[model samples]
Target: MTDDVRNIVLGVIAAGVSATLGWFTRSYLWRRRLRRKQAFFGLPENSECLLVVNRDPGTDGAVHRHDVFALLELSSIVKDCSAHVQILSHDVGRQGYGEHAEFCVGGPGSNRRTAAHLATLLPGVRINTDPEPGEDRAAFQLGSDRYRLETGVAEYVLLARLTGSQDSRPVFLFCGQRAIANQAATRYLARNHEKLARRHRTHSFVLLLKVVNSQAYGPDVVEVIGDVTRTAQTPPPAPDPETD
Candidate 1:
């Protein structure tokens, strides 16, 4: 080959080798950074948790309220452990009303801890829905109040009965929809009923509420119950004697 041709071939080969090395170096650094971050967060090297939130299906715009509950649940699970966690929220209907609202009302600080912990484990959390704004405050207020008055208190009483035993786990509260008209009743139900049950010193029950439509609500609630029950089966960490 002529001198010029040889020079051109050498340059091309050099460029290809340089590109390959750069790519490998970048991949290694990226992985190392990820490992360091995970270590700092104290996340388990390879386990995962699933977090879900329910959302209103009616609206076309804005972050749906259901996400609030999902985030809270995610936060709670991750508090002080390291595990890969996946957060999911179930979306049902246009009204944008469902179980998540109930979940959001209580335990704000504890919820945040769950979310922070999960963030360390998962790549990222997300909601599954298309955005749409629905009904005005008046409608939500009316519905919320009525639901509360009608079943809110009664529901809580039942929950308390179920959870008040010594066998009870920590009850994570969840709701299917906001009972605007029945706010007092609902709040009373959630607090009083659950509280009374807890006093029994039986089982610990963590109540999780997800807002859902009338037709499908029962099944959805059952599903959440199943998950909580399963989680409860996992032996809790030994209590710190110092704290006790």
Candidate 2:
């Protein structure tokens, strides 16, 4: 073979090797990310997850449009992990709670299951279901810290993750003051799961998420107010023996 011909052949082989390596590298990184997400969510591949759908309280058992959007976001996350999502209503049977990987949405006023979880799992977290005239509908009171609704400007939600004894999988609670806030909380979860995993791995946690500019952004703008794990789980202040 001529010298030029041999050089040309070698160049083609080198290009093929480079392309193959690139493909393998991308595949490896994608798998690694998938594994991390699965671990963080306590969901294995092909696992089953329960989606408890919340309905509008005064309506004819119909879900709010914003709440439906929230569920769609959650469904995409589950599908990404190759998991199956089984949707159930907020009024599921007792066998539900902690029996499987779950995502329970809405506030105590709307979802009875969410109310039960707040009463049982995070006992200290208090939400006012009934309000006097001119009072906020769902005011969250944890010790001295109070979160009230401000309509379009700002809204609050408590996003929590906990594993139950009945099932090894985690239950994500998306408790919000309003339907738009629920969508915002789920959006934040989808965007920040990786960061959240790094912060708390396989451990239960609760965060206060604030939705800013909901009218303009439509749940796209969210910020983590703070971590309320301890306060939500227990009273903020208890008299120590020494103090007592």
Which numbered prediction scores highest in lDDT against the true structure? 2
Model 1 earns a TM-score of 0.28
Clash pairs for candidate 2: none
RMSD of each: 19.1, 3.3
Candidate with top TM-score is 2
Clashes of 2: 0
lDDT of 1 by residue, 1-244 (tens): 9999999999999999999999999999987654543332223455443343433334442334334533543354344344555543333212211211112221111233222222222112111112233322111111112212123222211111122223221223332233221122233333344343334333333333332332434212221221233232334345678853
In angstroms, the error of model 2 at 52 is 0.3
lDDT of each: 0.33, 0.88
> For model 2, how does the per-residue alpha-carbon lDDT over 35-133 read when each residue is reduced to its tens digit?
999988767899888899999976899999999999999999999999998898988635645556889999999998899889888988989888454
